[model samples]
Target chain A: MKLEMRDQPGQLVAALQPISAVGGNIIAVIHQRETPAATETLDVQIVLELPEGRLSRLLELLREQGVSVVRIDEERLLYECTLIMIGHLMHTDLSDTVDRIDMTGSAEVTELSLVMPAISSPSSARITIRSTTREEMKKAIRILRSVAEQKDLLIIEPLEGA
Target chain B: MRIAILGFGSVGRGIARAILAKNLDITVTGLADSRSGIIDPAGIDLEAALSRKDNGGPCGSLDVTPADVVAKADYDVLVEVTPTNVDDGEPALGHIRGALRRGKHVVTSNKGPIALAYPELRDLAATNGVFLRYEATVCGAIPLIHAMKEGLAGNTISRLYGVFNGTCNYILTRMAEDGLTYEQALAEARELGYAEADPTYDVEGIDAGIKLVILANTVLDMRTTLDDVERTGITLLTPEALRLAEDQDCTIRLIGEIVPEAGVLRVSPRIIAKSHPLVVEGTLNAVTVETDLAGDLTFIGKGAGSVETASAVIGDLLYIRDRHVQGS
Candidate 1:
């Protein structure tokens, strides 16, 4: 089977540690040299042969680390993440808002934007962020809202609408 | 499954290389060109054929011509990688039509025929209950066709636009960074194997326009024509103009767009902000698609070159072969 791991400085070595600890043989790794994921990481497509029984535990161990594992099909949880932020995105700062959300140790911001116009803008910005899991994403959003509030911006929490 | 390759050019040779490397459930029955088609059901000497081309006895000398090979052979797959004509769009249309008539599954990297006759050719394939896929017709290895056809199938595509032409993008990139004159940039592109010597189709935006039509058909299910879409080439760009745009933090690229709004289709170019994700650099091509559900999805990759394009064509072949085996 194949898996894509986000390339951090120590990530390639760290990813293999869990597999080696559980007994897995690495086959080939196709690293797209020029193209890297947004997290300043390269995409490493690793072919591996692992023991059938230990595959589940191996995946659990990998997830326990702060690795952005994209594909794992044998026996693992399908991770999903969502975040909602409230702030004066138009007035405060757009990049700063993204930076704060990304600063959270767990989830990285996959998509975001501020809806204000170029000339005249509202004092508040609604930002949506996606990550790997709901809990980690919620914590990231909380940190983002705190930053927004400190910058004198309003933070809007996710709410069910009519 | 038995497959035969015609016109052992860049595309054909690349496909042969991939099939050998992947060791997929496929066997190359024969390879043919203008000289002769070679039939080796057990698998032809791919390396030998490539070496022959490199040494230059014939452009492609398998053992027979495409017509003779298809007429006398019992092959299930026929891959046509002939030269693409800008005006007539001949060889591609003839070969594909003939293959479909013969009940053979056809895959092509030729854009001339598919861009002009997508609906008609697709209907012909459906009527015969055979597959006709041309993933290489658009952006080389970008997978834009399948990305729209399968990946984002659930959303309603409202707008489709991108840096579809690598040649034009390459020219613009040089012109922007080096402050090269349009002529200098074009000359550099021609020398660098990015632009053809003539470069009429690429520079006139006709090539990208055709790709836009194909993308519209797949992404929005809208039937658009090359003449229907408005096109503007980068030939008229001046260093002063590019500089002005750069000052505005915008890069000028020859972009192809298809916007289907309330049953109306509009295709043209506009200067977008430099920070726009679609504003990719160099020979790299990027596409930004807006879907109702998926919001905005972006894809970037090598948009041209024989090997990259051949990879896409072979991908379609593997997919078709898979379906055929599964169905049977």
Candidate 2:
């Protein structure tokens, strides 16, 4: 279930609690806070398996909790990889790096987190990208490396099978 | 597939005709009307029964009763087109409970039973592993129910509002377009068989309110009753009030709305601009479902008619058939 929830405390928890209450097995959850379209609503893509014909009930539960589900992508993603980039991430235009990978239409950086340890020091981010196939994921990693190298950012390569 | 129809009214007869005319692969094993009932486990001859009823005769030969259809008929699905009784949802509600308890799929065009006991029947159907469908309950021929349930599958509907009652819409349209008073337009509607002799049900917004309750419960998963809807009908509207709306490029429409975020459901006569989708002309049902992904989708179609409603009923039947086929 892909949901668009208001970016606030407990919104993501409110969205996931219904899935759990409905006995859904949470396979993966890709919550990208920065990719929300226009509205500041957080974009949540969740993968889970439940009893057939239970999606509608879960959706209603989300609605009852004031969370707006944007879509339910039934297709399952087969390959996922998490990478960490360490450098002046914001100065290098992070959105451009994510957009280039997402524009490929097969792979997307569905989750991202940024942390700045000090005021003037470099900022690092962890990005989890997924695609329909392992080959597509490799292409995305290549794109990420190329983009990071061009921006003079150091890439801590993804751990094998991590 | 063997089926039993619990009502032999115009809507029921229309469904029979559609089943035959469309060459659907199903058999009517039993049919019961207000006055008489028919039963034939080997499949009833629909043409002969229809002809007999048309000639002012009992639907079946002397022996059968409605109770026999509910109890003895050997069928898989029960189609209930019985008269709506909103107060208690009796008879229809009783028949529906019987069918579901017997592990039979039930399809109904009655609104009262649904408006009153939707959650109960839904749980009953789920527990029994049978389907209970009521597409024709709200806006007949509009395919509104299926659109909300299946067509708009993944969309998270934020707000849903629409013009559901054709009788009210017709009266308002005639009054606005032809400069007629409410009573004058209502008489015209009665002449056209749109309004009943006791038009309280249509004019006082009860009909639309009942439908709003059904939609809120079924589509939005809100366990609401007809009483939960704050209803205000069109009997109080005057030509001057309409003219005042027209001066502002608006028209009066009976709108049933549900704001899920606010946890509110209401049916009232409101002034909407002529350009609005709900500003449909004469006896049409229009609904808009606002969603996060699909944006807003507007659907408009005939709200009443034997054949039109039969379309919705048979559509539900075919959906059940296809789902079972795929399941197996």
What is the lDDT of every predicted structure here? 0.71, 0.83
* TM-score of chain B for predicted candidate 1: 0.93
| Residue-level lDDT for B289 in candidate 1 | 88
lDDT by residue (A1-162, candidate 2, tens digit) is: 678878889988988999989887898898776664678778888888775567789888999999987777755666777655667778889999999999999899888877665667666566778886677888988898789779976554321332
- What does fnat come to for each candidate? 0.00, 0.00
Cα lDDT tens digits, model 2, B185-242, are: 9999999989889999988889988888898889987878877887777775666556
Q: For each candidate, what's the DockQ?
A: 0.01, 0.01
Tens-place lDDT digits, model 1, residues A1-162? 344555557777887788789888776777776764456655667767675577778878877775556776443212333222333455567787778767764556665544433454332232445554556666776676568558755333321110
Model 2 stretches astray by more than 4 angstroms: A1-162, B325-328
Q: How many residue pairs clash in each candidate?
A: 8, 0
TM-score each candidate: 0.64, 0.66
The parts of candidate 1 lying over 4 Å away from their true place are A1-162, B59-63, B262-269, B326-328
Over B1-328, each residue of candidate 1 has an lDDT whose tens digit, in order, gives 7777877777787887777778676777767866767766576777777777779766344456777666656678788777676565686687788888888899887777887787888898998889988888888899888888888888888877788888888888888898897899999988888888889888878888888777776556778777777655666555544554565566567777666884433323345567888778878889888899999898999987767988898788888887873422
